[model samples]
Target: MARRERTRHLIELGGLVQKAGLVELADDDRATLYGAMLDCAARVQADDAGTVLALWKRRGKRAFDAEETAEEEQR
Candidate 1:
């Protein structure tokens, strides 16, 4: 990916962590945060992933779209 795209990807992933309440759950511990993400990755690979992922994706998209709309309206 290009540098700009990579940066945006990282920012979005960070937002997901924040949105999931992981920041507080990890309590500023890098290892804890990483381990939690790893666990999540593993869980996503399990059965029922499709249904779970669809719901998550829908929520994330709605949140991102709402933020964009709010920002545009503010301008």
Candidate 2:
């Protein structure tokens, strides 16, 4: 059950990548997609990691909130 849950979690993360249009933007190139993620990881490892992470968190939260609002309006 734990393994299944983990698999689902990973799939949802992949869905976010697709939803973000990275898959299409990279033309389905796995290497490029991974490199982009690596760059994000590097940014989080920098001296201003906290500030960088906070900005990303805020942006992600806003995006999620906007998506939810749009879905609710459609309903």
Candidate 3:
């Protein structure tokens, strides 16, 4: 990916974390955040993966839709 695109992708992912309150849950502990991500990865790799993915997809779309709505309201 282009550098700018990659940077934007990373920023968006960080925003998702902030939207989900993960940053506050981590309490500035990088290790805790990393560990939580590893655990999520393991869950995604395990059985019933669709369940995890579907839930995440719903949540992510909800966040994106909310942002879009907020922007439209601002306009």
Q: Which candidate is the best by lDDT?
A: 2
Each candidate structure's TM-score, on Cα atoms with residue i matched to residue i, is: 0.63, 0.93, 0.75
Write candidate 1's Cα lDDT for 1-75 as tens digits.
599999999999898888778898889788999997788788888858998799878997998899899999999
Greater lDDT among 2 and 3 belongs to 2
lDDT of 3 by residue, 11-60 (tens): 99887778788889999688998899999999899859999899999988
Separately for all candidates shown, the number of backbone clashes (residues 3 or more apart, or on different chains) is 0, 0, 0
Candidate 3 shows a clash count of 0
- The TM-score obtained by model 1 is 0.63
Candidate order, lDDT descending: 2, 3, 1
Runs of candidate 3 with Cα error greater than 4 angstroms are 63-75
The true-versus-predicted C-alpha distance at residue 12 of model 1, in Å, is 5.8
Give lDDT per model, in order: 0.87, 0.95, 0.89
TM-score of 3: 0.75
lDDT of 3 at 15: 79
Query: Which prediction has more favorable lDDT, 1 or 3?
Result: 3
